[model samples]
Target chain A: MIGWKQIPPGMVILEAGSALKIKTGSWRAAYKPRWIEENCIQCLLCWLYCPDNAVKVEDGKRQDFDYEYCKGCGLCALECPGKKGNKAIVMEEEVR
Target chain B: MVTPLNLKELSKKELRFTAGHRLCAGCAAPTVVKMILLAACDYPVVVASSTGCLEVSSCISTYTAWKVPWIHSAFENAAATLSGVESMYKALKKQGKIDKEIKFIAICGDGGTYDIGLQSLSGAMERWHDMLYVCYNNEAYMNTGIQRSGATPTYADTTTCPAGSVIPGKPQPRKDLTKIMAAHGIPYVAQAAPSHWPDLMKKVRKALEIPGPKFMNIFTPCNRGWRTRTDDAILLSRLAVDTCFWPLYEVEKGVVRVTYKPKEKKPIEEFLKLQGRFRHLFEPGREQLISELQRMIDENWERLLKEEEIFASKEEEKEEVVK
Candidate 1:
């Protein structure tokens, strides 16, 4: 949680590039993406189309979603190039 | 030099706009925001957003999705605010208070840019502020219950301009905003749709590299407002460009260039049929409206080609004289 007490009144800290602290994945109340690694062609289309920077990539390969920040918009599923019924990513309901 | 051909590299670059903000599913604004931020990867970015969907959705009181420094001021003063910020940065850099290079960006919706914020945007442009003003034009004022804005296309049904027996959606055509921006004679001006990522990405890079004011009017389709499926936003944008309704073009230093021309230009109906806003226009009585819209698109496309030719010749003449 951000500490408001440490900051001055009516003044924002304007912390440069500090979005990492905010966990946004909890905002996904319904659907979440389940990546099927084997089906992925490594096209990286899902990573490019994701509105949120939730798609985690390492060393030019698709790692997985940073679920801590993914809002489960399912854009990756929509942009997945895998064949029907065998999509590299699938949008499923959150277990909770 | 992040090209659309290598947008995958963008994922490696630190994203200025992160995920988990509250933009709607398949909303195009986030794509626009991300692409612009990635385009400015060469410098530290400071963003200013007007009061619109992108601002309201992303920045709540306690949280923000923006990884870069951001400010949300008013419905019409984003450009004005950023101009001030850019001037301050310039002063601070000269005074040795700040040493690193910083780029300024102002994001506004069509309502803010084409209507309410027009004067402020024009003022900033005329002042030649060193920043980029990007209008994510979703056509109507979707933030305020789909009100008809200056950027709304002709005969499209908005809440304020509802279709009826007597009068169809907006009676007037959309204001030619990109041309208006180019008339400012700034360093760069462009009209891009997210459908063509590479073209848009290239424009963003070129615009940011330039020294003076830059403007980009991007066609952002709204799923809720357009009454289309969430996943159809990109498809809709592609159709828009294919129909030549939103031609991909740019103006740099008074020279006009058409970026992409579809091999077989799709009909306006292909673009108009998908959006529920234009559903009424397909009815039997509204056939004339379709023709009218098509005619308007054709006229604009012709004008763009003519302008490109004229400008290219002018550039050649200048080179000849210099030689």
Candidate 2:
């Protein structure tokens, strides 16, 4: 730990976006959302609603989850308005 | 009408509010933050957040969830914090010290916004600061363990005002914060929900472009405080809008505009039943409470529509006079 005098000006961490290094995906103790690519209509609601920004999207189309930071809130699966019984994203138990 | 919002193109913008930090699972605050940042993506941004969940969780010591410049403010002075920053920016720009355009935002949960920071907010708005004040209204003080706040809806059970056999939940109606901000007669005041991203983005964009104080009361559901499933924040937000419990509307220059009108307005039960905070309201003999809450919502909705009809034509008249 740095001394008070050694701390950056206003204690502001000079490095921007430093939180990306913290692997918050460990917070997901149980369920992890599985993105079934074929079922995705690419509405981007999952992308929009992910609290962690874990849903990886490119060019408006659905891609995969950045599990390193996902936190496995299962929000993507819960809000996916896919065809009945064949939702785009579904929660699976983390086999730890 | 404002230009069409292209979601596909917008999806490609750099994520200003990045991953990691300690916000609770299914926390709607991050989604709200992301939406606001995305809307203001075209410019460099500086955010001042009051001492609340977003501040406590997202920016802990050396780690920060924000990619852009960020400042943490006191519980009752986020508006003041941003106000000072904006004034400095203006001064520096005039002296040619800063060359780029930067957007300013003050964020707070309902705890700070509807109660603690209200005075500062009013003062800043009255002073016409070139900043946007966004309140992510989860309806209670969730970070402090779901205590009842001024924004907590009528009779919704909270830790401070827990429902029991003797007395049911919170005694007072939820404060109409958006309406109060509108009464300030600022350039823009809006009540949006994170569920409707397009409407929210549009409002944020419009608010930033207008060179005066703007306020947005965004309905962000708390999965923990509301005793909901971890994933229900977005849907609960949607239900809040559909039931008129939290209307999606904006008051631009004192003229009200309801953003999205549900083809069939859902009943308050649909919204209340989804959350455990309102579980007591549905119990036997508590039917009166439900009806009373419904009546309150209906009255507010009617008043908003009436205001829209009255002032909408007047807005057109102002435009005509300008032409």
Query: Whose DockQ is greatest here?
Result: 2
Per-prediction CA RMSD (Å): 2.8, 2.2
* Docking outcome class, model 2: medium
TM-score per candidate, chains pooled: 0.91, 0.95
lDDT of 1 by residue, B1-323 (tens): 33343756666787777665777767889988887887777778889999999988877655567888888789989999999999999999999999987888898999999999999999999999999899999998998789999999999899998999877999998899999999988889999998788788888888888899999999998988988876677788889999998999999988899999999999999999988999999888678889999999999999999999999898899999999
lDDT of 1 at B252: 90
Interface RMSD of 2: 1.0
- Best lDDT among the predictions, by candidate number: 2
lDDT of 1 at B73: 81
Give the top-scoring candidate (TM-score). 2
Candidate 2 lDDT, B1-323, residue by residue in tens: 33345666668888999899789999999999999998888888999999889999988878888998899858999999999999999999999999998999988999999999999999999999999999999899988899999999888899999999867899988888888999999999998998888899999999999999999999988888999998888889889899988899988888789888888889899999988988988889889988888899999889988888888788889999999
